[model samples]
Target: MTEGSLPRLELWCELQCPDCRTALDDVRALRERYGDALPIVLRHFPLEKHKHAYAAAEAAEEAFVQGRGWPFVEAVLARVTELERRGPELLVEVAGELGLDAEEVELALIDGRHTLAVDADQAEGKAIGVSGTPTYVVAGQRLDGGKSQQGLRERIVALLEG
Candidate 1:
């Protein structure tokens, strides 16, 4: 796809904690505000400190394989606190909430079937200098910080107009 056809915003985040969820909320609002005019791609960048982050990322990739990536992501974000508190069971619950087959998601997590894809996301983020959660790449401009709705909207508008 050409530059104009590509997504206007791409977010690199981890779903293992509540901070990422907060960031995702802003992303969701931006999408609602811009509609199809702004595209946001979610990439997994699970941190090493979060015990279940890697597994959660694997589950998300499995969901992607099952064509439920976005839903899986939303589920994860919705239960970030639960995931941090209760762990993988929360991830499974989120999968079930998204109508994903729990057994398959579990299998994917156990089998390491999607580990490479998740790792690749992390590698790409590192390559692009993402050393933290909630990093955003907007029209080739990288913004590393927790951005509020107004802040994000302003940057996106500037990118679109520039």
Candidate 2:
């Protein structure tokens, strides 16, 4: 997509890391502050080292097919710590909590139905030069660091002002 068609802010993140969750929180705060003026796209870049990373990405995409992409993303980030301690089952539980059909989620996970979607996300992220979790692209500028809510808001405001 052209820069004009791109979101004011786009987030390339992985759900398997606690740091990503924190960064996502900052993104959420920026969304609240800027509303539609700031658009954020969540892209999955599952780290190969994280045992359940790819599986989690697949799960989120499955939820997307069910029209619950954002909720699934929020649930995963909210339960990042629990997911590390517990397991993938907790992700399914979160999906259930978010009103997704548990059976469909289970089937999707078992069959790897959304594997391609996750793979596509990974490929796109790599093409965009995302080398790690929580990479933020704001108005065509890449910020490769963890950002706080206020910090993100400031950056977004600056972009808009410019």
Candidate 3:
């Protein structure tokens, strides 16, 4: 967050949360506006209430390792209901649809290779006072967008411009 350092946005999110899915709109808009100027990083913050959220987070990490992180996230977020209905199977299905190795995604989930990374993100998120999904940290500020995303994009813009 230093002055003249490249500004980054950390999105603490649960893949299964509906609010997090909605937050993707702002994420997409930011990507469209800033392109590579701004880096929007996704951090896992899977809430315990969501049954499949932890698995989804692990799957996302695997997708990231496979070089299709954002697209996999977007695709998974776009089908939250299906994810809730189908769990790990839905994760594998989405990976195949995106041309990723479906078997590898499944194995990663089962072997727990990405669990440590997801857990670390969750722990870091809690230490940073992230209490809910879709929370954003940018320019040393934490913006909670769980209930509303109003003025968030503007605030980020101001921080980036300031």
Candidate 4:
């Protein structure tokens, strides 16, 4: 469970979310800025309003199985427009571009293979009063904000220094 010298930050976010999409750079930058000292754990928290969120969550899990979770997420975030228009099908297209099996992502999405994990994340978040996307949990502190790179960096620095 020991990640490294720094702390683990759990990102409770949904794919195709504008807030989450806006934060993509910040999350990427945080990784580059901290390396292994700070690791981000992506947690599914698909809001009910977005119909594609759950399927996207499953696709992300499938991507993780293929060792391409980060790329898959980035791809989805990059095309929020397509996701809003096409729903789960967007995952297939993105996976294909990444050389991951498009059918595999589709099958996972259809059969609900990763629903349990996604559901568990939702339950955990709900229990902790997570009412929105892009919630960040660091050092047992829940920061429900836009999770901007600057904000995230400030929190991490404060945690590391304190």
Highest-TM-score candidate: 3
Off by over 4 Å in 1: 1-7, 147-150
RMSD to true structure for each model, in Å: 2.3, 3.0, 1.5, 2.1
Pairs with steric clashes in candidate 1: none
**Candidate 3 TM-score versus the reference:** 0.95
What TM-score, computed on C-alpha atoms, does each candidate reach?
A: 0.86, 0.83, 0.95, 0.91
Ranking by TM-score: 3, 4, 1, 2
Model 2 residue runs over 4 Å out of place are: 1-6, 147-150
Please estimate how well model 2 matches the true structure, expressed as its whole-model Cα lDDT. Answer: 0.77
Q: Candidate 2: worst 10 consecutive residues by lDDT?
A: 1-10
**lDDT (tens digit, per residue) of candidate 4 on 1-162:** 453476778888899788887666767777888877777899999988998988999999999999999899989988987899998877899999999988999999889999999999999999988899888888778877674445665775676545
Per-prediction count of colliding residue pairs? 0, 0, 0, 0
Give the C-alpha lDDT of model 1. 0.79
Give the whole-model CA lDDT for all candidates, comma-separated: 0.79, 0.77, 0.90, 0.85
lDDT of 1 by residue, 1-162 (tens): 465554568788888756676777677777787778677787888899999898898988888888998878878878777787888788778888788898899888778888888889999999999987888888788877554434765776677557
| Location of the lowest summed lDDT over 10 successive residues in candidate 3 | 1-10
